[model samples]
Target: MIPIYFCHRELLGLLFKSQIVLTDPSEPPLKTVHKFMQKQLTSNVSKPLSSDVIIKSNTGIFFVETTEKLEPSPLAVCAVESASQTYPDRTIYFFMKGLTKNMTITKSSFYKAIPLLSSMENVNILPLDLEEVVQDTPLYPWYQKVNPAKEQYWKHVSSDGFRLAVIWKYGGIYMDTDIVSLKPVQEINFLAVQDYQIVNSAILGFQKHHQFLWDCMEDFVKNYRGGIWGHQGPGLVTRMIERHCGMTVFKGTEDIICRDFSILNTQRFYPVPYQTWERYFQVWNPKDSFNNSYALHLWNFMNKNNKRVIIGSNSVVENLFMKRCPRTYELIIKHASRK
Candidate 1:
């Protein structure tokens, strides 16, 4: 379902023995997979744990930072809605339902938790009407509903609704939890990166009145167009937008002026003007004063050279943000560092 991207360095091999096994025959296969993963992840592998399961949980609210700019504002600064729940920590044991115990060194990473990374911010988990949202969005290749005529009416809508939901709930400048923060975010919506590559959602920003953003989301979701448009889906949206005719409205219009992004979905076909796809990684070698930037968007393959990291307790992105905001960073890091 969802991916859980977290830091896991100190407890690498140790997590294996703490894993859970599913043998319930009544549950669906996907259900079993979810349970197995949940236990392995949220099972609190800590030693001699307490009575409950949760360590920490909070829901940040989103409010308007400034009344002037609403179309595209910093989603987080806009305090909307946020809350969380958790139980005490405890340890448990189980048996393998499939393979033998010798299957050690498994690739048990947090794919589902990665997206929740952005949720760390006081994001408003609004009770949005799933049906309404699904209907307002555009049509994309990935929009699929097995029972089209019956239970999945909103399946046709594009990711615009999802994008809008994120902006409205969590703000644009959202950070994927898996991303290790490196520096202090000087300002909100600082356009650090160039206007290309679908404005990496891993670290993005916009104003509150950024209806243009909604428009962009609408265009991407409804128009079924995207060059590097992720979040709603992978590079699927990004791929479809390329099959367009020539001259198509000064491609940079959206990049430089219009924020819809859909107006210029051809980064692979063009240059990103002056944006450097660096800094959004584990190592940055720019000895010179690093300016004209806000935050790094470790979209994928956190390491620049794609180095095979051991996936430790603190991800590269987490370390980065804490380096910037010590108090805020440490609070989250120190708490998450628990067993």
Candidate 2:
């Protein structure tokens, strides 16, 4: 049974007392009430972090979660664990916009996974304050004025903006939570190709204050479209690539070098296209070696039904988790056995 922390009357009273500005009259009242409650809950549950805690530039692996869920999905846990294990020398920072300072085993649904991720010396699970992260970047002004609740694709738009801002502030690899790291990234500055013409922003690597990233941020605000999907993410990156690197199609598996950064081939990150996302969930005969890949993007977005990773499924995804993120794999097996 779900827990009810507040009655409808109290909720109404709280909503009336709060200072949340609903810019769009068409916006649902329920969403505004929910946001107010979330803000109140976050404030009550966690204290702010000290200013001394800092993320170093050029030597970090980043993963951002824009949702308010305290418990990360199993795939997200695996993504962080695999990156932590692969890059032991470099720091792995998992920034959750909803994360609070006091979220611990007793309070979070990710009790088992949280402790496991925290045990890694190189892993740092931190809070992601959108305003603070985009402070000095081009997105700052837009972020301040934009009413996220009014945007149709606010989640994706915010994530797209946050990645560029964070990467610009402190250089490193910015990978989506669905990407499982298999090897250390060799390129100093790079973007992964999603298809022949599109360069995906799911996995990016750059140095601090890279001009390419700055230009991307500028374009993000100039061409902002909350209603259009991918307009701020892959589309923005692809446009920037066309401007900087020219229109180059991927014919072979070789990396294309621009002025300062390189555009990696599709095999390096997205070995399986989104159209074939089920290939990851299905059992393979010989099993894929993924020899040419550095990491596999699971395309979790394509899993619309939210399929469970069965223990004995022996699917490609199961195998990847078993090998790349053994600890998370074990947890999955353990939970399934209990069920």
Candidate 3:
């Protein structure tokens, strides 16, 4: 009786408060008291505070900078699809600057190849209009003035500017369409190193209205040299890091935490160097699983003329497609059969 009273104080209190006086030693049965205590416990803390619970949300954005809206290549399909799969919970957006028509996941060409991408309700396709992105962006006026003589030059320089502007306005992520995501990007603000000496602007993540992004936009205008290759792209990003973080050359590991922002090593994005871009699509060691890499950049520009992802080839790219984007792999296999 003593132990029961100590264990169930509320029950004892209720029994004591009752008007009925228990003169008999066998007044309250232990079993009856246990049942009453159970009822009291259930009554006290049953319902949960439904509204007080907080839900976590994150947004990621990717862009395709092309002039015409052709069917998305398998690699391009893999890039967006893998990103969507890796971060299923996060809001994933794909921006096509050249596309005039808006497309839903159901209507998109890549949807047939990767059904998982279509199921991702969080994924959105948006048109990348310079006028829309540049309006509120700090470097709009500067972007208007730069006019490259050649179309190819414009494609490179304009994309460099657009990436910065859109990211500044939206504040999520800006990944080049060639990047195939392997895992969830954890850092809110990060830049990936292309090599030990250079940082690539191909992948950038930031919170909305990050001041560092604003500074990068400003620097793009001040150091506008569209003719020279990489001057406005990787070179600009490296220069900005040097100015702010005091990093002359980004010598870091898979993850580097700086005072201003975090930096990921070259292996995270560019596991296969530009010089050895073909090796990525070739038969390599099956054991070499790029464990440290979060994503792999196919370096489309470098391999544009030579390297192609064959359907039957047991190459690294094909293997990646099988494991990461299986539906896409099946689609490619069917296409190969038809061919």
Candidate 4:
């Protein structure tokens, strides 16, 4: 039996004293009571109170920013806020590599958004210590030997490595900051398909200590390429998928089970391909329902012109913000109105 430590003696007494009548004859009384206690404990401690009062059942949704930028982009903040709203029961963790423990919030508009992001009960804004995250993983040796200054694409390479390390360390979903969450993901272990032949690492879900993630980490270290763009990101995942499940094209939205893990169809995350990312910025006539899609990847990397989402534009992106992330939308409108 897993030992549960209680800080308050009164709370412990109240637990045992509470009437927990089990209707199912098949289930052991003790087991039923234990589950009830666990549920009670989880609901009571929604926010991080103490180390002992941890929410083990609540799945983790992680978003990492490898660059030393304390103030996250508006889209990144929207992604986090949307996820938090979608998964109120689950914990949404936003790790900023540049955020320090003692850092103060400045008066800048960007910095002010941090407090609003943190205001959500389920959202946790934490510091990302790369070295510490990769310590026990297979990527540790590679990370130690790698010189970020020498690497041409260190930002992309480091972000790729950090995403893998964090997911491996704590079993949950890892998504790029650019991607916004639309709904709760049901798959416990799966990878998002970017296209017919490639799988994108923008979003991934797996249990803690999964072999596929470990293999990916090992492959990441073995094939360690800092100079080649997408070599460590999508390229690494695509190669790993081919090795695990062999080359196969998904025809529909149905999930293809690749041994222990599953490969989700492109429509689930990438309904709008990167090639047509402009569709997000353009106004849709009929508007897309995207019933099958769990989330939308704005392809922020592909926005060369760096078009901002206008409140009255009625673009797909603006509508998404208004409906999916109201807090962020309000912030945008508030900032725009001030100017």
Candidate 5:
């Protein structure tokens, strides 16, 4: 007899199979597998939130400052531009520790071609001046250790620390530069999950002085792993959720409520998996693509070098670029055509 709490028919079947082990101990460890499956469904039953304002005061949309010179990439431009358009009422902040030299143009045609981002009235580009923003926070020590290097390790580390510090001080939502907002987000405190197990820190929200974020920053210092790429990013987020929420498996669903925070389904932000990152650039099913998603994570950090948003391409990314950051799109096509 399966427990009534296991209402999902599929889960009920799995639990029923696990009972076989009690009769025949030689059988597979179906009970362990059932527990694993249950944990994996953590997000499956998530209650989707509506587009209603939850927190009245700390309502801001934020993006990490990019070191690329000239303008940000079309995707980066779209990330901020779309957010501004989607949530006109919310203040947007673009924070960076420092600017890149030649912060005007990159040798590459597709990268850093959008100049319109600098002029958005709602978007404030602020320097991550440690003394002013993070000097007294728990994350300041990690910030001090963030010396720039030729390797990409420091960028991730600094970003992890900077985002935590800023949000802790001033509550708001923080998005990666690659994410394109498709609609206004309503949840005031939430985290996005990318897979069945890992919670991505790419898109995060919280009120000022959220304890979960402080815990995450403390974990970052205690378990700082500069060599491990995701140690401070997704890895730290996942571990923090476990430590604070007592969660083991994330089903990448929308209804997961831990204390006052919510866990968003991967479909909400990352409809396309990383393994199939090209789908964002390919128009497979226009009607079905991102139908219910509020934003799209183009995985630009992983695909920026190879992917180019052609002017007239009917791909999903090109479409998003044309619609969300039309000015930048026009500039890129115009320049590329002239050459």
Candidate 6:
């Protein structure tokens, strides 16, 4: 859930550079909207904020910033956007925007302030910068020794090409060249990062709703010097993650390749592993496609066609991605006509 005041353009400015999180509804940080969130929480819920907003739930999209006190005020909430005000179906809430600034209050204060919106366990206000919201994210320390550089340029290039192709054709998250289908999904309106093994910091979830995905992207672009873990794009994020002392404590079961990224059931493209499907995982043998494994990475590529990666069904690969991307197909036909 997002706080109301953070939406104000100027206050919101305070947020982009500040850290935030997607909290479980159970441990909500604020009890009531600070006079800041109260006065600032605009009725103006705009079009789904940038997927970059990050924290997500089945209900709605928002970016939250919390304060300690709930100084009272009665500022009428402003409309977020024209589209939002016009749509009756969308119920985007901007809670607690009328409270005072920088005051330290607790979840209990919020109930006294609003006297509405039933509270739950995670009902306390969430802190935008959780200097103490610590968690243990895990990883394999073996990668610490590798020198970061442009090793597999062609494969990376090809993957980029494929990514753009899918984005131009398919309208959701592009599966990394390595990912395979896991389970059948209904329909996802937003683009989510693709990975069952690791966070694709590469493949992104794009939805008008999520601004956090883009936030991660922007943060990577700004900070990444192409470190060993984050070679170019995703590596930047992972590298930052690598620096944190708390990272090693969480679940390290996921690989860095493709983790938690959802596999859409649109049947857009049926991708296989970089090797024979049967020979995908080296250390582990996964059973389910989407759950256990959705991709097989052909990591550590060199200029060696002699070192063959049995992409099992080459003809099948050709047949699978046979249809021209609609936009590209139209362009090609138009270009040919001109020629």
Best lDDT among the predictions, by candidate number? 2
Candidate 2: TM-score?
0.82
Q: Candidates' TM-scores?
A: 0.35, 0.82, 0.75, 0.82, 0.75, 0.29
**lDDT over C-alpha atoms for residue 305 of model 3:** 78
Model 6, global lDDT: 0.28
Worst 10 residues of 1 by lDDT: 86-95
Candidate 5 Cα errors over 4 Å, as ranges? 1-57, 66-70, 97-115, 150-152
Q: What is the TM-score (0 to 1) of candidate 1?
A: 0.35
For model 6, how does the per-residue alpha-carbon lDDT over 121-185 read when each residue is reduced to its tens digit? Answer: 11212223221111111111212322325433423432322232222222334333222223222
In the range 1-103, model 4's lDDT, one tens digit per residue, is 1111222212211111122223343432221112334455433443223221332422778888888986688889889888988888887777677765334
Please rank every candidate by lDDT, starting with the best. Answer: 2, 4, 5, 3, 1, 6
lDDT of 4: 0.73
Which runs in model 3 stand beyond 4 Å of their true positions?
1-58, 101-120, 148-151, 252-254
The CA root-mean-square deviation of candidate 5, after full C-alpha superposition on the true structure, stands at 22.0
Question: Runs in model 2 with CA error above 4 Å?
Answer: 1-53, 102-104, 107-110
Candidate 4 vs 6: which has more lDDT: 4
Best by TM-score: 2
Q: Write the per-residue lDDT of candidate 3 for residues 4-58, one digit (tens) a residue.
A: 1112111111111111222333523111112333343223333222111111122
Candidate 2 lDDT for residue 95: 69
* Candidate 4 C-alpha error for residue 169, in Å: 1.2
Q: How far off is residue 155 in model 6, in Å? A: 7.7
Query: Which one wins by TM-score: 1 or 5?
Result: 5
Residue-by-residue lDDT tens digits, candidate 5, 1-339: 111112111221011111121222342211111233333333344222211221233676767763534355556667787898888777676655444211322233343332245445565543344433555677778666655674367767677777787677668888898888888777889998888888998889999889988888889888988788889999999988888889878763555888899888878887788888998778646575576788888887678567877756788888887777676667664565668
